[model samples]
Target: MNGVLFDSFQHNSWATKVLLKVCSQLSAEQLATTAVGSYGNIIATFNHIILSDARYLHHLSGNAPEWLLNRDLSNDFAVLEARADEAANNWQQFFTQPVDGEQLTILVSGDYEIHAGALIAQALHHSNIHREQICAILTSLGIEPPDIQPWAYAHETGRGRDLPSEQ
Candidate 1:
């Protein structure tokens, strides 16, 4: 389970980097321009992704980093990129160590019970959904979004490869 979870986190981080790299090419106006059906613009959407990961990590760890607590969504691209990188590194470190999968109660809007593993899965799913939305927004703006598929990520990272068929 940990291995799978780790892979998912790795893919998530890889995809984020790819998207951010593509977004870096956009002009300031494009980065901030609002698009229909998106959180706001490319920068805003990326900020949401970073903040969401921070919130989940805080719930799981019972400690919120000062930077995360005081994050500004409208910060410059470099700041947002650093925050996203930090969040990804944190998740990598977390899964590299042992995690307690036992059920724990958290107070969000209300008290809810969940396990560590489930929270990780939720984070991964949430990121992917938002990533797709960002991709759609990029397409609408006539900018080609980078491919973020997990299989593509695996192939790029050399962590996975096609196997020959057994006749």
Candidate 2:
């Protein structure tokens, strides 16, 4: 996979973790709040994002981490953060490999097959979509949402830097 193709995965993980930390501070009641057009309440949306990311990652790489395999998934902040970090590492390794974008991922149960490239695209879009939904929930609750944008990720991770005045 090219750098840009994979780098977004890192950003997705980072941004999700960032937002998770922010949302972790909310009370259980607050976490249950929902906004119009969102996928679900804050807790549900966040959990869906984490769990579903692993689903796509698993299909993409044919390897699933313990966090993905374990059935003890919950809305616990610590568990979510741990899973997110583990997922980030896995995603990093996955990107280090050559990507066969044109390869087909067979789905016998569903009687369907999807291109790896399309799955990858869906994985990227899925996280962004859910994150926005969580942010919308926060906005509706009068809580300022964290900036989980790619620009913010770049700034935080030093992927982006201000160019000093040119000599």
Candidate 3:
């Protein structure tokens, strides 16, 4: 289960990078353009993704991430990308160490107790949904969003080729 979770995190990070690469091609105005049915615009959605990941990291690590707190959504693309990279690294590091999935409890709104693994899974799913929303926004803007499928990430990272042949 830990291995699967770790792989999913890697996939999420890969997809984020691909999306950011496509976002890099757009002008500031295009990145900030409002799209219906999205959290805000491309940049705002990206910021939400980053900050949410940071919050998850804080929950997992038990240390609040000061840098991610109180951030404005209007940050430039480069800054957001850098912050995303940092958040991804934090998640990767957490997965690298031994995680007591059953022992870690996340306090939800200071009332409910939830497993850390569940929260991580929720974060992963949430990110994917937001990524799709970003893709839709990009499409509406006449820009083709980059491919962010897990298979594409596996192929790009040489993991797909690593599987044994069925022959």
Candidate 4:
């Protein structure tokens, strides 16, 4: 019913689709490879990215941490896919209720406080940044990542184009 809520759902759904496509083609070893260097292995990197944002969500809303923060996995593919699903589900739950963007706030460790909407935006942007990293790693592994354009996911899902229709 709210515009912000709608946008959040759409963006996160697109991200989930991208993550699934990425993990689908990689072998377990390749998914766990640290060839990307300082960013950590693909599975670790993905978990880190999702967990970091979830941590912020906890800080902002006092929600409990999602499973990714504490879980260990013996299988790389399972871990990667599960983390993606967990992160998306958590985000979806958070956005299920609408709050006016202005009513949100980000608590600073010391003194500074930021707008909550800005923090949410930053978290999403952070995820997108790492998604690009994952994409790069996938490309290097000779796995073709899916076309993750928002329009593409929307159309594929029969959710229609994100762009405005022509008159």
lDDT of each: 0.80, 0.84, 0.80, 0.65
Candidate 2, 1-167: lDDT as tens digits: 45777568889999899999999999989998988888888878877888778878788777887766764567899988888888778778888878888999974236778998898899999999999999888888888998899899888899898889988
Q: Which of candidates 1 and 4 reaches a greater lDDT?
A: 1
Worst 10 residues of 4 by lDDT: 68-77
Question: How many residue pairs of model 3 clash at the backbone?
Answer: 0
**Residue-wise C-alpha lDDT for candidate 3, range 1-167, written one tens digit per residue:** 45667778889888887898888888888877876777888888888998888887787787545666665554676877777788888888788777876765755346667677788888898899899998998888888888899888878988786668899
Off by over 4 Å in 3: 72-74, 162-167
For model 1, residues 59-118, the per-residue Cα lDDT tens digits are 787656577687656556677778788888888777776787775748454678788778
lDDT of 2 at 106: 70
Cα-based RMSD of the predictions, in order? Answer: 2.5, 1.9, 2.8, 4.1
Question: What are the per-model numbers of colliding residue pairs?
Answer: 0, 0, 0, 0
What tens-digit string does per-residue lDDT give for candidate 4 at 20-134? 5668667878877665443776766666676666665665567644473464433355655565566567767776777555665655344556676777777777777777777
The Cα RMSD in angstroms, rounded to one decimal, for candidate 1 relative to the true structure is: 2.5
- TM-score ranking from best candidate downward: 2, 1, 3, 4
Model 2 ranges off by over 4 Å: 165-167
Residue 121, candidate 4: Cα error in Å is: 0.6
Q: What clash pairs does model 3 have?
A: none
